[model samples]
Target: MSEVVLTGVVKRYGPVTALDGVDLTVPAGALTAVLGPSGCGKTTLLRCLAGFERLDAGAIRVDGREVAGPGRHMPAHRRRIAVVPQEGALFPHLTVAANISYGLDRADRRGDRVDEVLALVGLAGYGDRMPHQLSGGQQQRVAVARALAPRPSLVLLDEPFSALDAGLRAGLRHDVREALRADGATAVLVTHDQGEALSVADRVVVLRSGRVVQSAAPGTLYREPADQWVAGFVGDAVLLPAVASAGAARTPLGTLPIAGPTTDGPVTVLVRPEQLRLAPASGTDAVTATVLRHDFHGHDALVALRLADDTRVTARVWDSTDPVEVGAEVAVRVDGTVRAWPATPVPAPAAAADPRPVHPVA
Candidate 1:
């Protein structure tokens, strides 16, 4: 296993900067995923780590040995790193055994190492098969086996499952993750898929515009995102404008509990759809809302609602719940801790507006 560390890493192309002052650490034996949209520097970061791209500034180190920095840059071949690209990149003319053994020394190649790696990647007894004979998923597994045959300290997967169909990608990614774990190989995966990163990685690093935005465990990143941008990107969030005073924020949904260091002023509260509940608008804490629409998605439903104040909110309900129809009046209940931030400035409200009863949904 190897620990990767990048300090003040910067990469540029002419006037365009792909990575700007990025600092990150990947723990030994743990799978870390670099997640971001396209052109967000995730791929460039991977290339720099693999020694394929040189850094304009900062340093890159693997297992405490400096690989890229001022006056020091190691070639890709000497880094002892293995890479699996989007496609399997297997030689059509070579058999699985020959491809895997290509990385082994002549003496090692003659041993049972090829068989061992094939079995490790769940491709046992298929060494004699040509690359073209295997399915896409199986071919990728062979690529992984080939990368592991030499037993390098680190492995880099560059969207290895992106090319496969959804169903095939899911199953192949599971097997690939398990294979890497079973062998205790430290891996760095780069992808734009949020589900893939959250499901398979021990740590997720979100980047945007050539900068690291947030780095945390999957659950923490999902539940407690750092800002509005991170919250919106990580999952579904309902943002509402409100005012904070005396430890509570009075939002359109009514006064909700908030825990954060903020002075009295306008704020924006973020509530997840799952945290809202619906029922008859009779309880003192329930606020009246008209069901605007219902989106039934197999296992659950996304019910859109408009409050008496005209603020819209969405709730995710299971199909097992009582059916709700459009234009139906219901009570909305807030069910969990509320996250609030300084609200963006808006124009003043118009005079002579209709007055309506607003109740707490807590």
Candidate 2:
């Protein structure tokens, strides 16, 4: 196990900067996920850590040893860092056991290390099978096993589950997490998938525009985002204009308790869909809204609503017995405290016509 640290890491491609002063610490024997949209520097950061790309400026330390830094650059093969890439990239001609033993030392390859890692990834007794004989999920398991066979100090998984089907992806994530934990392997996973990052990693680092926006545990990140953009990006958000005072805020849905302390003034309230409760519209104290749509999931349903004031919101309903129908009036209430941020004024429209001439479509 190794604790990886990156300080002021920067990578540039001519005038374009892919990574901008990124400072991160990956704890020993824990999985840390780097999450972001495309072009957000996730891949660039991973490449830097793996020694595939040299840093323009900054330092990388693994287990307190400088691997890439000023006046030093260790090649990828010498870093003892293993990467499990997307598509499982296994050799079709090699059997499951052979592929996993590929990276091991000559003597270790002839030992039980292959079977040990296979069992860790839940692929025991299938060593003789070729890569094509296994399912997609099984192939990914082989990839993970191959990475673990050599007992690397650190592991890097680059969107390892992106190529799998939805059902397979979810199951593979759980299995992979368990495999890494069982082996006590420290890993860094780079993925654009929000759910995968939140569920699989011990900590998630969110990146945007070549910089880290936030880094927190999954629960903390979901329950308390840094700002409105992160709130909307991580999960479903119901943002509303509100007036805050004391410990509560008044929104179109009525007064609701704030998550934490905030200044008294106009604010933008963040109400998660799961925080909204719906009931039959009858009580005068309850705010009423018309159901615009109901999306049914197996275990839960999302009910979209439009308040009398035309404010649209969504509520998550766990009970599927009494389904909410479209166009039906329902009473809406907030179940718990909500997050609030200072209100950002909407930009005013131009008072005069544009100086540039508008071309009429022929």
Candidate 3:
């Protein structure tokens, strides 16, 4: 396995910058996920690491050897890297064993490396079958096995599980992660699925507009996001306007105690849907809201509500409890200390004037 280090990496296409001053480190034998929206620079970063795309500025090193930099550029074939794309990209004319053993030296190919890799990917005895005969998930496993056959120093997976069904994708993800870890292979996975990144990666690197936004463990990124945008992007959140005074923030929901010292002023409080609890309206301390809608999601339901002052919020409740009907008054209370950010007030829309009815005349 190899450690990849990128410093101030920059790549541009004409006037568009696909990667802008990005710095990242993928440790040896660890799977790091690059997560972002569709147009973000994750794919570009992967290609750059694979030596397929040269950097416009900055440096890239693998195992302390400079591969891409000011006057140094290594060809893709020279790098000991393997790539598994969205599709399997197997050769139709060759059998699974032949496809996996394509690039190895004649002597090495004669050994049992193909079967070993196949076993690693959970396809021990399917080497003789053609790619067309295998299922989609099986075909992807073939691709992964082919990449690992040569014992590459690093592996790059570009949304490898995207084309499969949810069940197949989940299974394949688990199998692939295990195969990589068992082989002690360092990997970088580029994906847009938040759950996939959080569940599979040892560390997550979030990118936006060709720039690195945050890099940390999945739990840290989910619980204490760097900002409001990160918080909203990571999970479901309800932002409310609040005022801080004497270590407590007063919002429309209720007066919530703050954890750290802050300047007394207006702030934005972030409360996740799961933190909001619902109960029958009775106590004066609990805030009252009318149910706007209830969306049943098998094990749990999301109850939409509108406060007395017209503020909207959502609460996730267990489906086993009595179902909350639309327009039913319910009491809502926060269960934990909510996160607050610098206030950025959004101007409410101006009230519309009364519309006078005009009769149509012939």
| lDDT of all predictions | 0.84, 0.87, 0.85
lDDT of 3 by residue, 157-252 (tens): 989999999988998998999999988899999888998999999999988778888999999888777666667777678888899888789999
Give the TM-score (vs. native) of candidate 3: 0.90
Best by lDDT: 2
| Pairs of residues at least 3 apart in sequence or in different chains that clash in candidate 2 | none
Question: Candidate 1, after superposition: displacement of residue 349 in Å?
Answer: 31
By summed lDDT, the worst window of 10 consecutive residues in model 3 runs over 353-362
RMSD of 1: 10.3
Which prediction has more favorable lDDT, 1 or 3?
3
- TM-score: model 1 vs. ground truth: 0.89
Off by over 4 Å in 1: 283-285, 319-323, 344-362
TM-score: which candidate is best?
2
Considering TM-score, which of the candidate structures 1 and 2 is the better prediction for this target? 2
The reply for model 3, stretches above 4 Å from the true place, is 259-263, 319-321, 344-362
lDDT of 2 by residue, 282-345 (tens): 9687899999999999799999999999999999999976788899999998887999988985
Candidate 3 positional error at 141, Å: 1.1
Candidate 1's error at 112, in angstroms?
3.0
Write down the lDDT that model 3 would get. Answer: 0.85
TM-scores of all models?
0.89, 0.93, 0.90
